[model samples]
Target chain A: MINWSAFVVVVVVALVAAGVLVTLFSTALRVGDGDAPWRRPVSVGLYVVCGLVVAFGLYLIIPALHAG
Target chain B: MLVVALVIALALFFDFTNGFHDTANAMATPIATGALKPRVAVAIAAVLNLVGAFLSTEVAQTISGGLIREGPGGVQVTPVLILAGLIGAIVWNLVTWLLGLPSSSSHALFGGLIGAVIVGAGIGAIDGGVLVSKILIPAVLAPFTAGLISFIATKIAYSITKKRERDNFKRGQVFTSALVSLAHGTNDAQKTMGVITLALIAGGLQKAGTGPELWVIVVCAVAIAVGTYTGGWRIIKTIGRGITDIEPAQGFAAEVATTATILASTHLGFALSTTQVASGSVIGTGVGRKGASVRWKTAGRIALGWLITIPASAAVGALAAFLAGLGLWGIILDVVLAAAAILVIFLRSRRNRVDHRDFHLPQPGAFVRPKKRKKAVAGG
Candidate 1:
């Protein structure tokens, strides 16, 4: 049982890592352009998307353990 | 058994996408440097990627057998699981591409498998040893090695071509680019072949955990070749221009570094992310050159993505497994979710078409700035 969750957790960690990576890369690229066109909203969109995936995943996956 | 064929096709599709999306990694610097013409360079890379697809199956074997354990159900991997994982990866890739972030498709694939497998077979199914030694270790090391090599190579490339005419140096980049393309084929194309082979074994169409078949090898190669030809221009811009301003010499240095590191890892079945290595090399070369900004914040973002891919995929994978096991409703939800993800990606990509032309004409330092010495050295 531990192993199962562990694997899932590791993969979750990987997903978060990929998300953070994009955020970091974008922040770096967008450095100093205080008014660059369409960058912040784009960054927000990415983060929001990542958040949704993470949240939705938890919502769907966590319930299964109890119901099953 | 038919599912096995389907999985194999999906795997090849992933490989094809990998080839095109990652085309920037292998050929960008060369193209940026004007060493190889865009069309010719892609052709060279495509042929070599096909060749490389045939060169090895150890990594594929590792993925199919070692990374994720199958159930008493006889090494089965549901097509839905594979498809779900692909959706996760594809979505992530598209998002990153739009932002010009050079994230790793290989890691995404690995994470997807880990995700899907965890949900489908339980965590006990994963081989921690394999994921760590085979995937993580290479992930950490390849970029470091590439960066180091690129640092040295950049220094030398500049010294050698220090006084050559600009056009002459550009000419030299062409040959080197071709070499990198060949090397790219060898290193990257084989990954899909491995995935499909794993699918076949899982579906019990072949010996369990065996090497890929000859047909698997051929088709995977062709798919990736075609993908390479199509060009993942968003990545090309992100990798080529965003990391730092890459001059022709820097381009040459980055390509050589990327090629060497990629070829060496593929041979050993380490399954490292070529995107990360290429990005690191490009950034490193940027630092090796004078007055280059490291873009530490962007590097941090990419690092975060690397950190999440496995776990996120696994979480999604686990959910997929649970739902998939739940019977029809689960399948329906899965299908709806997959469709939504695909639609989102398609809509987003349509807005601003990323094409090869992004490579041909740069934005004339649209993103250049002052460099911090310590930060520059760090990315280097």
Candidate 2:
């Protein structure tokens, strides 16, 4: 039997992640150029979050991380 | 032992072609957007591919164990059979590369293997259920899904900021493209590892269901990495500039969508083609942005290439298997013929070379003589 559930889950997760990441990164770029006092901190936070996502993605690829 | 060695060599060569052939998948947009220099982009992709290869063995295991059947009732795939299939794949890959088409290397491999198996060991060797569920299903779905995600993402990105400074988006592209390269390494390099391990198992040097050995992984990684460093500039030109005019923001969106889709598919044990995913995302981003016109003609050509890749490569695989089945002399003849064909393709490519140095120039269309005439006028 095909694991259709896994396939659906992958599709959903990837779509959500791609949407969220693009929005977040683009917003961060917008905020960085704003004149508001809080813009700098908010942009920094978003960049940090993006960095963490990339780091986590890299970590997941390491075989030992998933191995029991 | 000699035949096993030959199979391993061919597998590595396939890996090398896979590396250069698919470099466009991760780095094309970045190069197009000037987010990274051509050479620097390929260098980064090469290193990430090497590092990424060490990250997972799941895909390798899938290739070595799950795709083909073993035992008395199943089709027996010997090392010679594997070699013949690889020759088919390599020939197809080189032909497509010479034509500047970004077809799927994954499909070429699958088609070649399946075709050789049918000719050499009969259709019973294939797991039809796995083929449909795992390989075929994902192949059809992944690109559309990736395209949709990228399309939505690009719209959202443009909506967020109508005209922002591109520097930040270019910076973001560097990261997203790196992620795509890493995901590519995790997926594509493992295919070669799987093929080599399959050959080893067929030769009785390894257990039937085990993952590739450490040495096999290392050699495959190095081969692919070296190939990545070489850069498939022709395909890069096609993906980066031929299909659509891409800005930095669009590049970032496309790369992120591609990375997400490839990683997700890899996690699910689906061997999707990175080339198709990347191409789909590029086209999707093109459609997402208002007033951005995708070169529908070029997209159609790429789609046509994808449609033909499987059956065309399969035909060649079957033919190679038929010829090699004759005897030892036949195997030698196949090798000689394949080598001559490859050399002829290489020499022909020199007549109109596209390299990293001039990849950004307006490329000649498949049937356009005007560009060549213009070039001649300018030279004179």
Candidate 3:
């Protein structure tokens, strides 16, 4: 009766996604803290990657946007 | 027709309670961390919920998938039974709200329906396999799963970011929290839409096995949005301040974890509670951060509330179904009693009134543990 497989997938996905997002954002914050010329661009790039992940999340939510 | 209309109204009302009850899930941490002001946070959540309601209805389809038998060879569920169930859910929602406990509105609704079905129909009417696979298991795992994710995320968040860089996380929180609100709208509003659709079908107004009508979706969205805007500040204070002193980093971690977990569950059609996942995330952050004190007493109360929500609402649903079985006057009596209870709860809420101003912004770099005040320190 239990859909253990789906439950497992949810756990694994949540852990990985949350960990990656937090780590990326935090690393960007740390790198961007001091005003080094390269640091700003690097952190900005990381921020863009984070934005892409959020965009992917949006894509997942909008059923009309995706093909079944 | 009247019974169907009444049930739809009650379903929307339950959706509204769901909105305010769970505004705390997404907006609480952001509001607590001053990433977004309390008013601004709720406003954003409300709008996103409205938009999110239109995004998907996948979860809605699974809401009553096979829980109650209502076709040939099965007992037909009456609109009055649904009404009784709604009353059961709403009463529990309000009572939990009054106590500032973040319980599962989904569980309450399911429990109410299960109770009403059991009373109105025989135990044979309920599919125990579906109940266990969909609702019961998800209820048990949601918190722990979200909590584990949040715990790890929190640890990683604190490790890399310096105290001065905390504002980066604060800024990030606004976006993450917004995602949670959007996910909430897609998830929670769908539940109401599903209930209304089911009622319409049961009443023979809509074809069986069809999706919610556009009108149903729109109204449910608006009701939930308005309720989100109104804000359940009492529950917010309890989750935001009551759980643990949330910093920007921890808030960010919790919000991200919650958003991911909710979206994943929604995608998988797992009938998980957003409240449970959010609460678990916050508590997870508490445990993750070194020196952060978790109010075990408050956490225990929340855990207790989760454990009892289904049974408590079921008991009420059973009684309500019994009463509703008596005919029109009994239904009227249930309605009158529900209205009275709602009014009383609202008045009692005012006595210890909690609102946006109750959450004060903490000074940067100064870690302040929220004082466990016996009386809520409030202004007007």
Candidate 4:
């Protein structure tokens, strides 16, 4: 009965954790003398796609009894 | 009785590792900035950490109740499960230490525990909602909050001191360093208390829902304190000097940022990693300051280790748990593995002796002291 929901939840949580952490650390990401949020460019796309996949997997995999 | 002893031993071992693993959080900045002599800083930090460990066990209560399922059958924790986790966590710590990567010891500990629980008792044994809502939320939020706070704090520090002299700012580093150490004690040492308490509950030595006993708290605090005095120079060197150039103000800012975040989390019974928060704050300070470079390569290695520590330790824990189900031989095996691991770690650390004397010195000529002009700005 495991589905994408649990996986989604996991990915979403991880992404948020990563995102929030990275964003909070945004002030620390500036390359010497650089002010642009370089992390934004890669962070958004990377988190979205990866987050979805991870979430889907968790949703699917975690609900079952331990068959392993 | 033996099970209780083993669990207590495991908790102390974890506490010992926490003390060594997390020494940098409290001392790195001060050492880097020469605010306190390396030995002096660690010695002070070690004592305060012990004091802090005894201050509260709210977080320990949470770990006992929040992370795993508990009921009339008692805590449902097994010595083998905990031993497995300890093994996993120790291995991860050693590997990371060898590579000089600073990672979150908290996560490794959590990961090992969860992994063992899942493998041994099944997923039903976990409190997933609590995992996501409480521990996970803080774990993810804390470091970033620390980073942001450090960023703003650094900026504020920069402008206010823009008219001051530098020595005054360096002097300030000493106070902030002390706070970081105190905060480190409050946060990291409690984790050991929680684990040990969990073991006690599982072993029926204590009430299922109660906190650690006064004696248990004292022993863990002392063990961690001694471990703190032992020094985590590899991580200290890497964190203090490897990531970026930190000045007196930046060091103060990072410490303050770290302190605020950890105190809040601990109060709420959240099990976040002080090391991660400290690193993030240090990195944030680097980004806030001009001309500071974060060593991305080192950061990347640490990130990779962080990714693996949980799962890796969990696997080891699970395997250990499975074997422990075999009885006395399993305990014997766990003991051997532990003894061997300890000898290896002891031997490895001796390869490069970093005493209290050289704890603050950067690798010759590579020291990152702030410039003289900035000193004028800080003091004037």
Candidate 5:
């Protein structure tokens, strides 16, 4: 018995996550372009978020992470 | 014992081809956008593919235990049948690669196995419900879903930043493409592991319904990594330039869409084709852009290739299985014919050599209008 509901939920979540990640990455790059006072901190925070996302992806790849 | 060893060797060869054949799925957009150099991109992908192979065995378990049944009341799938199936898959992959078509290697393998099993055992060996529910349904749906997601993502990306440095988007493409590569390795490499594990079980070298052995994982990972590093430059050119001209932003969006779709499918233990997902995302981004065009003729050709891959590979598998069922002489003849076919394809490919240098070459039949001449006949 295939769980079609779970498949749909996962697909939606993946799509939203992709959209959000791209948006965030692009925004971080845009804000880091100039010497504004808020640029440094905002850029740093955004980069950290992006890095964390990647780290989370790596975590998922590790079999131990999913072990109950 | 000897046949089991040969089957293991052939499975690794299939994994190797699967690697180079699919390199374009993850790296083509990045290379097209100049986000990463061709050699550097492949090296990175190769390393990540190796790491990703060790991640999970869910897909392998599905292939070993779910697709074909064993024990009482189940049809017997012998090692010879598996060999014929692998040969069928390998031949189709090579032919498709030479033609620069991004067909589904996963489907080819599945079709080969199904064909061989039918001829060698019977249709009763296969679990039809699992084939449809797990493999077939996902194969048809994944591409469209990826395309739609990429279309939306590309549109949103353009709207947010009207004018920005290309370098920024290129940097983002590097990260996104890497994710796609990692996802590809996780998904595609496991398929070979599954086949080999299945073979081992049939040969009584391993227990039935067990996950792939440690050695199986290691060999499959290394074979795929080496193949990736070789880089299927011909298909890379087709995907990177033949479909549509890609900018860094579109590349990022496409790669992101591909990564998400493949990763989600892998999580669910579905052995979907990464090639289809990547192609769909590429087409989706092309449609998303305002003035960009997708080359319809090339796309049509790819679509046609997709439609026939399963049946064509299955036919070859069935023929090979029929021959291999005759015993020792039949097996030797099957090997000879497979080798000869591969050799011919390899020789023919040398006539139109495409490599790293030709990655950016203008595709044949690209829309180039003739230059206008002065209108002397008009008597201005």
Candidate 6:
């Protein structure tokens, strides 16, 4: 039997994860290149968040980490 | 024993094809957008694949997964049946490669096995419900799910970034593409390991229901890594440029979407086709970007390729199983024909060679540039 719930989880997680990662990264680049004083810290914060998301992705891929 | 040896060898060969055929899924966009040089992109993908193969084997355990009846009460699965199945898969892979299509290697393998099992055993040997739920439904869903994600991601990416900053997404592609390669290794190399383990069990060299041996894992990993390094330039050309022109932002979006879908599916043990998911992402990006045109003809052809891959490979598998059933000479004949067919396909490919250089240059008849491509197509 098809695990409809699992399928739904995959779809929802993929959408949210992809949306957040790209949004943060793109927003970082958009503002980071600006001359405004506050832009530097804001972009840096966004990049760090993007890095964390990627790390979480690695967590999912690696079985040992994923299981734990 | 000899038959089992052949099955092992063919399974490895299929594994190799699986690697090269899928290298594009991870590396094509990076190569196309110049984020990484073609050779370097493939090298990174290869190394990641090598590392990923050792990461997990959860998917490998359920590879056959009720598709074939294989216990005490189940139909006997012979080495020759597997060999026929392998031949079917390999031949279809080569044919699709020569035509420069991005079809699913997993489906080809499964279809081959299904056909061979039915012929070698009986129609009752296949669990119809499992096939429908697992393989068929996933094939229908994978592309749409990936495409939807990519579409939404691409729009957000473009809308948030300025024109100049858009190209900066190229840097992110390096990481996302690498993730995909690692995911590919985790998902794909294990399929071959599962097959070899099945052969070992069926041949009685190992116990039934156990996992692959360490030696088997090492060899399968090496085979797939080497195959990824070799790179399927023809198929890469199709995916990277044929379907749509990929900007750095679109590439980043497509790769991110692909990586997310594949990892999630792998975690859930949802055995969908990576190629389908990757292809879908690219097309989704094409549609998402304003004013960007998707080559509907090419997309349609690729869709047709996916539709026929199973039945076409199944027919060949059935034929090979029929021949292989005749005995020793039968298997030998199947081997000879497969070898000859493979050689011919390789030679034919040389007539319109695609290489890393073509990533930058539009070969007259190549699909890289639509304008030049149309003229070339007409002249030819």
Model 1, A1-68: lDDT tens per residue? 12334333433343243323223322323332235757556645654663454344333222232345
Q: Can you write out model 4's per-residue Cα lDDT over A1-68, one digit (the tens) per residue?
A: 22234434433443343334333222222211223567455534543553453344323222231223
**Every model's DockQ:** 0.02, 0.57, 0.75, 0.02, 0.43, 0.71
lDDT of each: 0.62, 0.83, 0.87, 0.67, 0.81, 0.88
Ranking by DockQ: 3, 6, 2, 5, 4, 1
lDDT of 5: 0.81
lDDT of 2 by residue, B268-325 (tens): 7554678888999999999998888899999888888888887787777888888889
Residue B153 in candidate 1, Cα distance off native in Å: 1.3
lDDT value, residue B17 of candidate 5: 89
The Cα error of candidate 1 at residue B293, in Å, is: 2.8
lDDT of 1 by residue, B1-380 (tens): 54455456556667766777778877777767656666777777777666655554334445444566655643456666775566555556655666666667767776776777677766776778877866676667656766776776676655433232222334335644555565566556666766666566656676975666778777877898898887787777667666777776577566656655554444333444678778878877887877777777777776777777667655655565566667667766765675586578768888998776656654464222234334447644
Per-residue error at B244 for model 1, in Å?
1.1
Best DockQ among the predictions, by candidate number:
3
For candidate 4, the per-residue lDDT at B352 reads: 80
Off by over 4 Å in 5: A1-3, B57-59, B62-65, B209-211, B268-271, B360-380
Model 6 regions more than 4 Å off: B59-63, B361-380
Model 6, position B273: C-alpha lDDT score: 83
Each candidate's fnat, listed in order, reads 0.00, 0.63, 0.73, 0.00, 0.41, 0.70
Measured by lDDT, the strongest candidate is: 6
Question: Where does the lowest 10-residue lDDT sum fall in candidate 4 chain B?
Answer: B160-169
Candidate 4, residues B1-380, lDDT tens digits: the string is: 68668877877887888887788888888888777788888898898888777654455454534567865553466666777777777767766776677777777777777777887788788777866665555555656767777777777666544422333345546655666666677667777787777777777778877777888888988988988888788888888888887777677677766665554444333435678778878888888777678887877776677667777777767776776777889877877877787789778878886656666455443334467546548634
TM value for model 5: 0.91
Residue B351 accuracy (lDDT) in model 1: 92
